[model samples]
Target: MTATIDRAHAAARRGPVARAYRFELVKLVSQWRIRLLALACWIAPALFVAAVSRQSTLPVDTLFGRWMHATGWAGSLVMLGFAGTWALPLLMSLVAGDVFAAEDRLGTWRHLLVAVRSPRRIFAAKTLASLTVILLLVAGLAVSSAAGGILAVGNQPLVGLDGHLLAAPDAAGRVLLAWVCVLAPTLALAGIGLLGSVALVRSPMGLLLPVLLALALQLAQMLPLPVAVRLALPGYTFIAWTGLFTSPAQPGPLLIGIAVSVVWAATATALAYLLFLRRDFTNPAHDGPGRRAVTLGVLPLAALVAATVAVVAAAGATGPGIEQDKVQRSVATAFSHLYRLQTAQLNRPDVTEAQLAATAACNKGGGRLDARGPGNDWRCVVTWHLPGIEAAGTAVYQLDITPDGRFMADGDGPKEVNGYFLVRTPTGDAPNPLWQFDGNVALLPAAPKG
Candidate 1:
């Protein structure tokens, strides 16, 4: 059709301003994929919250506590870092990959341009459609994840990075804010995928290439690149999100992360539009050797894979080198060695799940102290009280784990010989150890939950 040819010719000519809007609208349907992705997103966080909420090990409740336990209660933090850092970028890729590239996949670009009557308008539509849906899908996933988390875990007090527990209101607010901050970095990821889509119109690999590129970037971050490299990654948003855990929570990294992602996204999208316009689909030579030399050409795949291996190796090699430290050692395989049941302790009247529930009412007010001893030994000062003990002075106890698996306690002001572990007993009673004290060495052993 004369009309169809004209439209194709126009998408090539649309100025930068128009292309932005064009890309955004065409993929409003990304929401369908989002709806599906939502199922997995919602279910995963909820299940984590539920599993954590039901656990008897953590001294209290929290999202990170659940995350920590999932990290095998602090013992597996290094392993978690190695594996999960890639997750955000991978997720962002699913949506970004389909944006501009999907038009090519469906063979709609030429047809739609004809219908639009203006190349500029088509570009605007596509860009707008892509960005809008990407933002919404991410927002929806965040909200759903938070909602499921709140409902599953209950808005209980949250423990902080310093092991300081926060009241419910602040805890709830922080979690939601952290989820929102994630949006900026995620958009950066979407931007990368969008650029790939726009550039690779003729190939099915367009959908997959952006993801491969992101992984490559993640890998490069680990190599001995200049300092600038660390500051520039679009997906570095995930790392910046770590602010949610730091004391006084720094926004500097998060804001910088947004700036980098946005700038790169804008630049990449502009380049894609220029390149796509210069080539005519009808021209066989466009995909020929000359254009081939412009990119890593056929080698983005090899580059991406090599980067993957490098990063995995780099992260493993560069950790804090604390493997031999006692804090890094497992006291007993957690949960595997269940605390030897004391039927006498269980039969005691106050030690019931109901009494343990009383702990929920225990007003959480405590100061933090970081203390260390002779054996690669670090002490976490928990100034806490067992509920039901009002006259009891605030005790700053030294939570010491020896160079081996042994834990020791030296604290001020308590006739209690050890800290109390409020536990559930199968023999009908769960101790309301709200104020009871126990030795610091008590670690129940069990394999991490599946």
Candidate 2:
């Protein structure tokens, strides 16, 4: 009797919310699934780095995948991008989606309520516990991936998309920053899962609902929706960290990503909190007034959709592609710069701009429309020369320019220009040692047309 009284006294002193929070934390850490997930977060990247290190070909499609086999820092960034797409949502949902539903599944709601006077405190405790788990998991993945990549491939100078080279320390710092940047989206995904968990009241629905929602949002980004809508999506923010790897690092996308993620997370969490407040844990069937509960629930969803439509309408239609004169001038200048870089790598004499005598004739869709703006239909015929190569063979360039004046060009020219070019080294002929400007080239701003 004395022990029971002491226990009661201790519980009373601690307060109901604090005690519930402690209970939730204990339950969360004790679960086998959470343990396995934490272990996987640390071990999976090591295995991935080890296995990919053995491969011959690099994954060029992904932002940093092309350098993974050769650079450890690149490999970590590649893994971070890959994880954001689906793995992150699944990991967050593992605990969050089941946090509330599990209580119902195990018939422990009554016991929990008996221990905790207020249901609101119990709800807050569970949400806090799930969020805490997400935070730890993200930190673990970042550390493991960085450590694993360094161990597997070694810290090498990382090449940016614009052909800039970052030193080992700088590369590592940027890669870690990229990993840290993804936490915004991860937290947003966790909140989504928590909201689903409370609303669905079934473990499986809660788990799969957030995952499906995330997948749908990802697919929507591919559609030709307004820029505002695309920017608002969680998936778009996932890749925003790539900007950190660029020269003069672009922060606009990263800032927008963080803001959008915060809004999404806050909105979802607020809705979940409201729903939990109204829920009747003692009797599963009756959860406040059904009509009023649904109206409140639908408000969040309606707000999201209405905001998307409003932004899309406000942005107006997409602008026309870049002008033809602008494209020709931009292409000629960029091509000359790229050729000079190539020549420098070969230990060959630099080609003068006057010697380049570069001339470009561009057309869009085989002359179907005015080649004035950005589009994939652009094709430019460029003529330039090296000492040995003939000017007779014109380089056929396919260019795609963004509305923001950024462009990527691919040319059907000499094989020497395609992959690793041969350079004159002191010790016989060797492959060009630095990052090649083969894939993408950023152009200088075109001069104002007269």
Candidate 3:
């Protein structure tokens, strides 16, 4: 009899929590709000893909935007970048923020706990349900976007950041990988919404707080903060997937993004769990005074702002810009690569880096100013051979360096070599070839003297 009683008690304990989780899932699915949101997630990408399919020009400012009209895969990646800006956060918050606060709004928390006999169980159930909804939403968006892209644009070879063409199958795999990469930061946003839901106990505050926080962090990135600080923000992680679309696939940024996202999500979820444990759901009046709640909220935000200011102040205002020698070397090397790509497009014989015998001399601002800093007045005189034209020419490049050592150079030279360059296509037609020295290029370090 004792053994039978113990078995019955164990079954009883398991039954309620399982039932509560099921109830939460059912409740979420049954709601029109969630249903509509999920439907929108599925439909929005299709509409965006269709609308942008007709555009003649590519949005090169955004990652993968340059190739959107070229392939359905690129279209999906472009949308992913757009979504990460705000849509991901907003969509995640919509459900996560409401999971707990909705009960408070309905005045059903007491009943919910009483029925389950454990707030812990209810919290777990609701959290699990919210997570399940998020997973479904993410999957829905990924599938719809990928399908829409494939159907509307068709798969084509993608141009990588390094100016190499990625085969269609390889590009498709990377695009899907990029979508998966975004989920890490999306979960962090969900955690923030969950924290707001439990801590604020108001649906509006829960929904808007996370979104506002994300926006604030994004704005903070625009300030002259240290790279480390900027990298720590969840918003920075959103673009880390761009590295995946590059040649040889740089995974460093993606790894850092995942690490930072994990930290933020873990911190927020832990804080939410602790706060939820201490709350008294029996009496709504026991939820504490408004002023005290406001103080608690403001304190953290103020601390963050102060810390940012202090770090910026300590780091000082200057960054090590590109050195003159570096600029000269980079300009020569880049010109070689650019010319090589151009010649290859015309079915010319392979031009060796040695064959060009490229050389460059750089000057800053037409005067003796510091070339080791970012400025628009830098110039480089580059001389290289054009094997196809069987001639050599000197090009004067007007260069600008970014704080991060990126260089953009525009040159006045032979129109054939300067204004437009081509990439070899399988279809034997050059469509919208890249321009040399017309876009951002990384400065190459000076070769070590033997």
**Judged by lDDT, which candidate is best?**
3
Tens-place lDDT digits, model 3, residues 1-450: 999999999999888878999999999999998999899888988887766766776675555665677778877877887778777888877888778888877888778877887878887888889889998888777788878888888888776654556889998888888888888888888888887888778637777876887788777755545445555566656766766654445575466567767766766776677677878776875443345444544465455445643543354422342467756766776676656666666777887778888898888867678666567788888887755666767777777665434455665555555644344456565643335343323222223579
Model 2 spans > 4 angstroms off: 1-16, 284-294, 308-411, 419-450
- Compared with the true structure, all predictions reach lDDT values of 0.45, 0.69, 0.70
Q: Across residues 78-116, which tens digit of lDDT does each residue of candidate 1 receive?
A: 212322355456565666666555555566666666666
- For model 1, the stretches where C-alpha displacement exceeds 4 angstroms are 1-27, 30-35, 38-44, 55-88, 217-228, 281-450
For TM-score, candidate 1 versus 3, the one ahead is 3
Ordered by lDDT, highest first, the candidates read 3, 2, 1
Steric clashes per prediction: 44, 6, 0
Estimated TM-score for each candidate: 0.55, 0.78, 0.78
